[model samples]
Target: MKVTLERNHLLKSLGHVHRVVERRNTYPILANVLMSATGDGLDLRATDLDIEVTETVPAMTATPGTTTVPAHTLYEIVRKLSDGADVVLETDGNDQMLISSGRSRFHLACLNPDGFPDLKSGAFTHTFAIKVQTLKDLIERTQFAISNEETRYYLNGIFVHTVDGPDGVVMRAVATDGHRLARVEAEAPQGSAGMPGIIIPRKTVAEVLKLLDGVEDEVKVELSDTKIRFTLGGVILLSKLIEGSFPDYERVTPKNNDKALVVDRDSLARAVDRVSTIASERGGKAVKLALTPGQLELSVTNPDHGTANEELAVEFDLEGFEIGFNARYLLEIIAQIRTENATFMFNDAGSPTLVREDGETKALFVLMPMRV
Candidate 1:
């Protein structure tokens, strides 16, 4: 097998799919990327059995064939090559891959292409087109709240489905990590109505986001009961669906949190950032937000590293109240706020609280308060 591709083109293509390759692996072939030549380009593919990504890059095909070579090794070698230099790759009958650029050359051990798992492209029970920006916004608004705990596999993804929204039916995405929750709504794409919700695993969400990078064009989505495929421009991604149901997130969100406080998102972020500096050293690492009628005082005490405080003038049209929260969790949800001002609705210190943009109801965040 042989192919000739520019250094930059090789690097660009590898950047899209390398993240799917696991660093440590049980299968030898899983560590390598499968390279095969098409009519005028090379197709690079990498997978960890659960998720697979494939991309096409322009290359001069010397001989159309396939071989699997170590993903990171090839990426590192191509990355260090002189910019724009042409790279030549060739493999022997034994699967040893030879890569050459100018005076530099490398021979990396390769695994047989047959062992590289085949990505079974399944039929789409339902297919649809979605704007790139809409998908990006949904992910950014909810990804921060995705649970990282593997044991609670059901909560480790962003739940996406159609719901009867305030403005008729709308597509919504929800994510929660037990401590905090984020929900974003978008006008459901035509034909996406009535589509049942699906929980997109965190890894797939991240990879799909990376694939969407640099692409403003509409992406084609095909989904089945067991798998989902994302097609955008020249890249394609296939992922196995998480085989469990997500938690009842709707029931967990508070319907009416009476205490309302409106504050500038940037101001809240900065105050949280500053106070967390001291909280980072304390047990439970909590931050206390004491809200008065017109002032919001943020404070954190370490008991070992003293305390930090910041006061922000806010539109707190409520009685005196206080809430304790983990400093990291508060900062994460606040960072997702894109608007100038944010609004918080609190039931009490012991109940779940809701947050949203001051004037927008499209996105909502819920956080469970901590006992500091």
Candidate 2:
């Protein structure tokens, strides 16, 4: 196989798909990217058994053929080459791929393209198009809550589905890690009302986010019972659905928490950061929040580090109450709030707390209190 492509174009295409290649692979071919050169352009494909990404870039095809080369190694070589330089790729009889730039050349071992796993494209039961910004918002607001634990595999990704909102049907994304939960809603795209709820794995969510970054055009999404595909620009991403049921998240969202405390998001985040400095070094030290009529005081105590406290004025008129929370968890949720004010609804010191932006009901957070 032989092809010539602009340095920037080759680098961009490789960058998009190389991330899907797993660093540690038991199979040799799984670590390489399959490259197919045609008269039109070049096709690059990479996969990690579960998720696969393919991208096509315009190139000058010298000879229409196919070969496989190490994804990361080739990407790094192309990245270091002088910008705007034309890169030539060809495979020799010795089963090695030759890479050449203006004044540099390298040969990498090539594997037979026949060993590369074929990604089966199945019929999609549902298909729709969504605005890039809307989908990006849903992911950015909730992805941080996805669980990293492997035992509870169901909680390892964001739950995406359609739900009834105040105005009408809307697309919602929810994620929880047992300690904190985040839910964000956006208007459902046309013809997506009957889409089946799917659990998008954590790694797939990350890849999708990266693909959506800075993309203003609409993204096409197709889904089936066992697989999902996203197509945007010149790239197509196919991922296997997580074969597990997510928990009933609505049951855990408190509906009877009456006490309300409205405070500036930045102010509360800063206070939490200051007080947690003296907190336990192990678990992000628990910080105690004492709420009164118009004042909120945050304090932390650690036998080995010392103690710290900070006070901030807030809009609370309920009876005084104190609650304990992990400092790191609190900051993570607060960082998602874009509005100036954040509202917290609490039932008691031991019960889970509900948080939201002051006047927005489209997004909500539930955080379980910690014992100080």
Candidate 3:
């Protein structure tokens, strides 16, 4: 395609889609981004079979056409160009795309646009609009708990659905990796009622987070049984939904954990970090939390490393008990808490522990204890 675009604008658009291009692809066209130039602007599309991202940038069309070029290579070239420089992209007859900016020039091998796979978007059965910050909050609160194990494919994404929350209906996002679970809910937005539950894959969630990083505008979401689409500003992301049933997460959440301990979130997180420093480096080392009337002690021991112990004043009325937990898990959950105190509810030393912000019911974290 023959078009001239500002260097920064072209680079930003390329950054959005190039991430979806697979580094090693069986099909040559899959490694390239489809660039189409029209009188209005330039359209850039990239995909990795399961997910597709498209971005549009205003450009001056010299000779309107379409071509496919290496996504990463083109991005790197544009990124290195001087700021504010006008970038010119045109196809040469010898199956190559020429990129020029000021004194810099590069020729990249091009593929036929026809060879690029079409990103199939199914008709959406449900469509909703949500505030960018609300969606981002749901992801940040639970995404850390998504499983990385390939065998349990269903656990590799956040389970999103409508739930009867404490305050009327709300949209809930839950994720668990068997060791720890995170559940966060937000007030349901307009047109979200009766939407079917969907599992958004980890990769797609990452991409969506990137798109909404600094954006505060509302994002339009369209979904079907097998596909999901997100439109924000001038960008469009379409992803295939994971076709598996998520576990019944409600059953895993402890219902009657009575023992309560309230500790400053920062203090607890710092204590865990300090104690875990001397913990075993192999498996996520376990930290022992000893809770008494109004004091909590965190301790860790490793054969190779030394031992660490820290005491923090907390608000606990339960009888003294000790529980073992993965230090890393505690830190991750603590990072999600935005309030001053992190409340912990425990049934026993061997049972799962429930954690949440003090006096907050919209977000909760459950962590399975580890044997010390």
- Model 1: colliding residue pairs: none
- List where candidate 2 sits over 4 angstroms from the true fold: none
* lDDT per residue (tens digit) for residues 1-372 in model 1: 788999999999998888899999999889899999867799999999999999999999878888889998889999999999999999877459889999998999988888889879677677889999999999988999998899999888888888987688898999988989999999988878877678888999998887787788698888887788889888889998877887888898889788889899998988898888877543667999999989999998887788899999999867898899888888888888888988898999999989888788899899899887
lDDT of each: 0.88, 0.92, 0.92
Best-to-worst order by lDDT is 2, 3, 1
lDDT of 3 at 167: 71
lDDT for 186 (candidate 1): 93
The local lDDT score (0 to 100) that residue 297 gets in candidate 3 is 92
In candidate 2, clashing pairs total 0
What tens digits encode model 2's per-residue C-alpha lDDT throughout 119-233?
7878989999999989898999999999999999999999999988779999999999999999999999997898999999999989999988746779999999789999977
lDDT of 3: 0.92
TM-scores of the models, in the given order? 0.96, 0.98, 0.98
